[model samples]
Target: MTPSETKEHSPMQQQAQTFGYRLLKQDGAARLGEVVTPRGIVRTPAFMPVGTVATVKALTFDQVKQAGADIVLANTYHLMLRPGAERVARLGGLHNFMRWDGPILTDSGGFQVMSLSKIRKINEEGVRFASHIDGSRHLLTPERAVEIQCLLGSDIQMQLDECISLPAERKETERAMELSLRWAARAQRAFSDLAKPGQALFGIVQGGVDAELRQRSAEALVAMDLPGYAVGGLAVGEGQELMLRTLDGVLPHLPSHKPRYLMGVGTPSDLIKSVARGVDMFDCVMPTRNGRHGLAFTWNGKVNLRNARHADDPAPLDEQSSCPGARDYSRAYLHHLVRSGEYLGAMLLSWVNTTFYQELMAAMRLAIAEGRFNTWAEETLDRIERTN
Candidate 1:
């Protein structure tokens, strides 16, 4: 669904026309819903392709849109480093610059900052880190993070918070969680000051893998009553079981009406299971990253094109698939291209993998609306998790 450009409005007018979330249906904890934004209608159980630097790797916006994605995610850390947030705003914001009319979400860059812990210092104000690009120094405070996203004109903006690695001490986890809560408050205040009409700021829940800390984090963010909440700090070496268990403990505390986003998660199986636990949105680099390496996702299971078995196979990746990238090319050809290090191989596989992800989300939305998500998820997971 194409959305019109943002129109200038008074703060009171913008507040009256803020972002909305509507739950259309539910089966068990799974939901069929819509995130109503000025940019577009993002279908619930949506998989936003990771457009880290305002573009999905190896695919154009047309290809992404054709893959049935209602929204795409961009990174704050990367853009702020390279093109600069102020530069983007001067160039008519991210949507105009990128030419994607659909809704766009900008990460707060906290996770990327966390990954550079060796080169960064974290304190009450925020993290001071050197840019990976050129080692330029910059301080990323909660207020600054919110300001960057507002400058980028993101429809859905994330709060800046500290994210610790898994298997951390309770004291460490508690410290980071409490710090994130304080940051969330500052982020909200900054968002209030800078965010334009139709722009929304989402708070992220961080507590590592501890359920008690997860609940505490969720509850505090819930009290803030942001437009959306994200379960961050998962899929960072935490096993699937622990991640799911963490969701079990924390999701109940989040308001049902607002959208719940699971950050940087996961496989197809992860999406299905998380949907059963009440997550509404997701973003990850798995599909494109795996695709660029000769792995493609499909309805049946994972397909490794670099494998010798596919070198002479006459079959397409999926003859039943609607995506031409998946349905029109033979496995033998893809195997040759991948083995030969052809760029076309990466491009086609990225397209196939992304389309497959969108298809999975669509199927889940339908099943949730039909009141059979649990049954459907179990059977589908058994099929898709198996290697082809």
Candidate 2:
């Protein structure tokens, strides 16, 4: 039977009848937990690779699973625009369409739509924007955002919120945050109206960079008692320091029992530091995107495979990696493949990079469970910075 149709929850699912988090362990502000879903349980400190167009660029869903991702993220805006949400639902939802039965989280598409400001107009109702695919006009209401995610059969759905660029005046930030709060209420009402089983909806905290504004945004969303909470509006040209500071300012206000997600955030170091500050789930396209650009993220640090210095280097990116590209293929060969623009280069590097990220999350999970996350992070960061 389909997950939604299951009359009986599994033993593990019984522990969490609906979608939720069970805190397993904690060290400092870092936490280790399990996100119990109908499809499976996602370990805490999870990093969801962005499969923005229903695919993770070059890699297949099997490769994504092999790389250790318990859950993958999809874009609501993109899917709603192309192929259409109704079309996906008719084909048996995103899980059947993508052939991935595991848990899936979908974004509200607010960020992507906001990026098309030149072609979009914003008001109290929602954003009316032009589609990039064919320049067709569309109105993205908060109610419609929840509707799309529901049609996609997303296990974890993000509520529609306004995301603003950094360096904005306090007045602008307050305006956006207040608007997001309104959207959160409308989105929640719409989500509850459907009341789909075995799924959860999350509210986003957005306020640009102001401390008071962020705190206000967090407090408002917290009042809603969302199933999860996401810290948005960072990684939008805001430096790492400010981002972490914002997390520090905002996270304390969110409930610890629920999962805390940092949206569209960043590199290996960024993950390390954010976890240190109490964030649990994260999603980003850095690894796959950079892999396609001829870059590799290793435990030792990032490797620029396109550089000529590696033309004669016989060493692989990492001899210990399970991924053949990092464990078996030599730097010289990888360099040549990248230089020649071979498809294998992108595939191999994408797999290798994604594997490394999962490895990092696994390592952090272990450390947090063992009460050694602080020391582990310190040593790991030192190693990454010192390595090439």
Candidate 3:
């Protein structure tokens, strides 16, 4: 049935409804479930493609839909910089502005402000920074962050929190964590006051890589009882093992019934490992970004289209694949386009990468549901790690 035909409720009504998340199945710590949002239901173990600038890089909304994404993540930092969040709302919110009626989750812009902007100063009130786009000044507090997301009419909104860079001193991490907790409280208040039907607010747990700090942040955010929770500040520069260890440290503190999102991660191996650690949602730019650079991820391993070996090859990138870019286009053609700097090369490869990523998530969901995720993960990892 069409979305219009489906039952509709005001955002506030949906928020008032007791938020429920049921574990449908599991394989080890990996889980399969559904997140019933006011916009719609999203199958857990879901991978939200990054639509940083209100678009999923090279692909259209329909193409993203075909890639098997149940939700798309937009960057508040980018959107607020250009076009402007207020402008987007005036144009009728992100869904209408982007022409994608499906569910959307918007980051609080804190991460980008910390990592991407220049001269960022953090205080009790909020962060003040020069815009990365035009060097214009802007202030983003917890309340202002919520106000922006509300204006964009996001289905899932994140609270503004400080994300400390790793390799940080213990004292620095503690300071950031404490500040984030205070901001989370302010964000909670803002969200409560602006509560609308169908939309939900999420609080992010931040602590760099310190286990104690992570637990503290999680416990504090949990106290606020947000609809969902996200594990942020992990994938910055820490290696995979460190990130997983951090997840192990933090996951136990988060409520099992609420959806757990791991922000800005990662490689295929990373996704599998995070799922095994009980993470339920993810968003990353690796697939599209790497695809544009001529890298293709496959079950057999990564293939570089710039290699001369594919110059005369007649076989598709992967004949056994379902995506047209992977199963239909000859390697030689892809190589030529990529080497010649043609736009279609990036488009096709990006499409394939997206499809592959979705297929990987689908396989993971099925494996967990069937209680064989461990075996599936091992075999999948072995195949991809194979070289020559």
Global fold similarity of model 1 (TM-score): 0.95
Q: Give the per-residue lDDT digits (tens) of candidate 2, residues 62-106.
A: 988877788999999999988999999999999999999789999
Pairs in clash, predicted candidate 3: 10-197, 11-196, 11-197, 11-198, 12-196, 12-197
Estimate TM-scores for all models.
0.95, 0.95, 0.94
Give the worst 10-residue stretch by lDDT in candidate 1: 1-10
Worst 10 residues of 3 by lDDT: 1-10
A best-first ranking of the candidates according to their lDDT comes to 1, 2, 3
The Cα local distance difference test for each model comes to 0.89, 0.88, 0.85
Cand. 2 TM to true fold? 0.95
- TM-score, cand. 3: 0.94
lDDT of 1 by residue, 52-135 (tens): 999999999999988888899999999999799999999999999999988899999999987853489999999999888888
For the record, the alpha-carbon RMSD of candidate 2 to the native fold, in angstroms, is: 5.4
Pairs clashing within candidate 1? none
Q: What is the lDDT of residue 28 in candidate 3?
A: 74
Q: Pick the candidate with the highest lDDT.
A: 1
Evaluation by TM-score, superior candidate among 1 and 3: 1
lDDT of 3: 0.85
